[model samples]
Target: MGAAIDPQVLAARVRNALPAKFASEKRMFGGITFMVNGNMLCCVSKRGLMACVGAAAEPEALARPFASPCFGSGRRMAGFVTVAPPGVADADGLNYWLALARTYVEATPRNASGQKRWRRKSAATEPSRAAA
Candidate 1:
């Protein structure tokens, strides 16, 4: 529980700021993560704007007002930062963070898909539980 904006509102803003092409979204880490070409660009959640600004840019991003290190599972997440609600209260503020995420994501290698590459076993592939 932090100074977070409504996830829906933030999600709408993200949709407006980023292009649909090469962008996809998924529910992860208790919120929705926007992925670009398979890499996480940013996320909107109750915790705030979780941005994947890359490790090199992490320091500068954290230096900005209302920005703090992003944490997951009680540990600091490298190359990510959480911008508090005040930091993204206005459209301009939100856009700024989105731009940073876009720049970083663009430079990364593209995956086969814009979504996670996790492989799930289908019913046919799954071991027969009854036999076990």
Candidate 2:
């Protein structure tokens, strides 16, 4: 399926708020993700915006209206929160979340080598997409 508008707009707004040197965009999980210092800073998925504010801030971030603990696939991601579409309807609201994520991202260390730190599982570990 094609990408949805609300998430797309949310992603764009956050991307704009990030410092050029701190943010790099990558498309993943059928949405846009912003990486900072080789770590995932934030992303906008079909459900809405997902922010990684570090483990310490997750509780406060989840208190916002329309905010919820975030998950990837079926498992919960401890440091992330999902800001619902209603929560980020306006630019100001969008930036508010962006600022939260930026704070944690800014404090994180960067890998100057610039090599990708994550590795995908081998195709052999899973079922094939091709029909039998």
RMSD of each: 4.3, 6.1
Against the correct fold, how does model 1 do in TM-score? 0.82
- lDDT for each residue of candidate 1 in 5-97, tens digit (9 for 90 to 100): 789888888898887685799998888999887888998987789999999999999999999998899999999999988888898989999
Clashes of 2: 0
User: What is the C-alpha lDDT profile of model 2 across 5-123, one tens digit per residue?
Assistant: 56666776776777667778888766798887777777887777888888998998988888888777899989889887777778887888888987887887875535866979898
Per-candidate clashes, comma-separated: 0, 0
Among these predicted structures, which one has the highest lDDT?
1
